[model samples]
Target: MPYITVKMLEGRTEEQKRNLVEKVTDAVSETTGAPKEKVVVFIEEMSKNHYGIAGKRVSDQ
Candidate 1:
């Protein structure tokens, strides 16, 4: 089994996330020769306040 985690700022439509998972699963399965059912995709969403860049929080920008 292959496990994948994707972290990004929160605020995407359900459809977008669904598509992302589908595409990622397909790519992983194709490259690693893992079955689609055996490939796991995890989505981690964070708020702007929890994300930082250039020594500053995104929520502060």
Candidate 2:
């Protein structure tokens, strides 16, 4: 089985998240020779206040 994790900022529609998971699963399966059913993709979302860049929090920008 192949496990993949995608971390990004919060705020995405259900349809978008569905598409993202589908595409990511396909890519992982194709690259690792894992069956589609055996490929796992995890989506982790964080709020702007929880994310930071260049010494500044996203929420403050």
* TM-scores of all candidate predictions against the true structure: 0.95, 0.95
In model 1, which regions exceed 4 Å deviation? none
Let me know the TM-score candidate 1 reaches against the reference structure: 0.95
Candidate 1 residue 36 C-alpha distance from true site, Å: 0.3
> What is the Cα-based lDDT of residue 17 in candidate 2?
97
Q: Taking the tens digit of each residue's C-alpha lDDT, what string does model 1 give over 1-55?
A: 9999999999999999999999999999999999999999999999999999999
Q: Global lDDT for candidate 2?
A: 0.94
Return the lDDT, model 2, position 54.
100
Number of backbone collisions per candidate: 0, 0
- Each prediction's whole-model lDDT (CA): 0.98, 0.94
Considering every candidate listed, which one attains the maximal lDDT? Answer: 1
